[model samples]
Target: MGPAGEVLWDVALPASPSRLPGATMAGFADRGRTPAGLRLIPPPAVTLALVFGPGTVVLSGAAGRGSVVAGLGFGTTRVRQAADFSCVQVRLPPAVAGAVLGVRPAELGGAFVALDDLWGRDAARLAERLSETSSWDERFALTDAVLARRAEAGPAADPEVAWAWRRLVRTRGLVRVERLASEVGWSRKRLWSRFQAQIGLPPKRAARLVRFDHAVHRLVAGQEAAFVAADAGYADQSHLHRDVRAFTGITPATVAGEPFLTVDDVAWPSSR
Candidate 1:
């Protein structure tokens, strides 16, 4: 339990390896920490996260409301809060890149932005009401409604950006940005601009996040650290250590061994 009396769900990812082909596995987290100021927690890896319930609002530290609800990238971190209730969170696969970052799951590496910017006041209220409902069917209906609105409001897709994103995932971050730009036939600046507009972050940052996410999945599933590091494209164990520290504020070894709430936690899996 946290400082507040609210209970927390024992979050876990799906156990099936067959479901994940190029990215980390997805998980669900239901937490009711407190209705206080936002609390920032480092994820196990870079991922697209969804705030699926009411009362909760994710805030960005650097960009404030402007950065709160977007599909943030790998190194980005945000403060999370629930005004008077709890919230549910769902993780997205790394391969599933977002198209527009302002409100939809189509954005890649978008930062946390304001809920109002994405869902608006009415949608937010609907989510709040749905959170109090007991039936899964009701919840699903509410979710569908919200998704429909989001789809309607989402930004148009750019084939070039989509193609580049696909290539990046297929190559697992081994491909260079310049090569991607050339393949898309867009100037480097043009590519970056389009990517930022649609994905919230540049392609390189998204790629790194995806790469780190892959490494974390392997580590969590009992893979050897050294081998996982190599496969993830690190120069060596030390390079992997640096990458983790840069994004998560911890070394790979510490993360390999523990359940870390923040990047600073020791790298060990949870005792349970």
Candidate 2:
């Protein structure tokens, strides 16, 4: 472990099933040793990770260029190609995460696709350079450049969708979709379409993710089940358990007393 405690969220990629022709698969693992505490990572995910000890080079799988390191938040999705066989992972802030996906953190409930949709060849080259960097500062600078470009190239999010997002954040998972639509002067159908376009997922799904995110935060911070359930807007403790399992595939007890470390948890800090 680094400055933090033991690597709490270590998960290896599972083997792919045979019989699929030339199947390409990807997964991510987070080490809990970094100085950053619990993170709120969201979905429609994008990440490529490799672990290198302190003062080592980090590189992607291919020999590309123009790589950058970015910190993203929950509810942003992008395609990530891993660099370096092993390297320290970093946490992402919501803004950067939104920039990468060409959407805001408030809009992330769709499936992940290729980076080409957003970055084209530049993304591939960046992956290569990310794998080759020696200094973390250089990596971070490159990441900043990438984020800047993404911010420039990415489309502006819908004002109404953003408005709904602000309300969701404020409620801490207690707001309703009808209220959101009325506040934004949109029909439910119109709101869903606009929200999906800007944020990848529909409002209901986003709300669920947000609610689950809050529950995880409560667990990580060691709140009692009763309080966590109520504060997170669950119907009750059992409701919280059901939702937690749906997203994380684990029980609240499994994560209790430990800082929550799911991708969703890492992307949505406010929920935490």
Candidate 3:
């Protein structure tokens, strides 16, 4: 129970070996009736939430307002319902999100949209399927199969863009954009345009987000802010503070205490 006597159950689902690359899933079940909500900090990957409970889950952010199903990518922090909610969160690489969600990452960048608006009737069918199933495992299986089918049916990202995204993640966003562009045989301008169109954020901002994600986790792990700043490639402690505030509207100390990040290591052990 929380201070408000709220009960929250968190379930982390292992990625099935058969699942598509660059996709991960988790489940959250909150039973509190306290009109609770949370500030969802923006991460590097695109996010999709499937809500299948009596409680309506509303998301307000760059993408705008929505309830039931929410889609967010490459944007500012979003506020979502925190109690009386049960849902599954799917994290997808921006490259594949366009294929799976029928909308480019750039379209949803820095905003929230109703999933039904994007997926149409398929979204309704999915909600019904998930709600009808009593087993969490069943719900996960259904979602994975749906995503796999959609991804296979939709167009894949340009090879150059996909390669660049992988490299960014591999290097923790420390690699130079120019270097990545050259390696991918794309001019800097070309890379920037395509990346923004496909992945939502420009290369430079994406790198910062990826690096900031690393630093935030370290802080949540109890590392000192100065050390995390230096290690994360920030110019100084103040730089880290400014970046954290920009992303989460909070200071590093406050970010270090976020329950969302604190539970991440346990829930997504291989998030890095």
Candidate 4:
């Protein structure tokens, strides 16, 4: 809680996003004395969390105060270390993730990869630069500039695949694959193949994840599970239960109290 007793997490956003055609960001800090367990919930996009500060952020059992990337999938990752780190996290939609990350999102295979693995020395240098930076605004600017440059220089998603992914996102994953394939003038097999190749997950899996993301947030907002299931397009409360467990390895009640989703509105904002 903040000084005023509001639901507060020391998180900030850019004054205005200069780039990020389909991305959102947040600046996060934790200062509890005890070690913190941050259960990262995967959204519908690729995530990059850049860490730089007095303490460490341990992901996938490796302690790195640098940066880590989380590709799209149903996996549970916890931060294991002192709870005194500041991080700038960015979530990029498939349309921009491939270009910004400079590789097919499929290459990540729903796992955690240190930024050094992909960007090498550049990642170290960026961490140092961010640590030296004094203001959150400057930090956001530096991160955004690098992403824009990378997007301009790197590979791009196929136009058809990009369109299909966007459709899934816009519809909250409620649209059918056949509808997308027909709209793109491609057979279902071809669309599935290309989307998996570029976006990192097959069409059905990606849609399920997207739908889960939408439903999870509603749960976090304090809605009853039965009501959320009906409203979120799940076939039944049991279906919602299965998805929540499959994605986070926890029940809906536990998910409702998670700090990751609790801080989402302030950190991520609902616009994008």
Which candidate gets the maximum TM-score versus the true structure? 4
lDDT per residue (tens digit) for residues 193-271 in model 4? 9999999999998999999999999987878999989987899999999998988999999888777777777777864
> How accurate locally, in lDDT, is each candidate?
0.50, 0.50, 0.75, 0.83
Q: How many pairs of residues in model 1 come into backbone collision?
A: 24
- lDDT for predicted candidate 3 compared with the true structure: 0.75
Better of 1 and 3 by lDDT: 3
Lowest-scoring 10 consecutive residues by lDDT in candidate 1? 263-272
Q: Per-residue lDDT tens digits of candidate 3, residues 1-272?
A: 22332434556574464277877788777656323345566667887888776656655543322223223333344445444667778888888888988778787746767787788778878877888988778888898999899998887899899889989988888999999999988899999999988888899998888888999989988899999999989999999999898888888998776656666765566685
Worst ten in a row by lDDT for model 4: 1-10
What are the RMSDs of all candidates, in order?
A: 7.0, 10.9, 2.7, 2.3
Give Cα distance to truth, residue 114, candidate 4, Å.
0.4
What lDDT tens digits, residue by residue, belong to model 1 across residues 1-272?
23332333334332322122223322234454433432343342223333444344445453322113335443435444444333333233222323222343434234454545544665457555655767544554554444445434555447787687668767876788899999999998999888666555577876776677667656756688799888989889787777677776666655554333322212112211
Q: Which regions of candidate 2 deviate over 4 angstroms?
A: 1-5, 8-99, 102-109, 112-120, 257-272
Regions more than 4 Å wrong, model 3: 1-7, 33-37, 61-83
Better of 1 and 2 by TM-score: 1
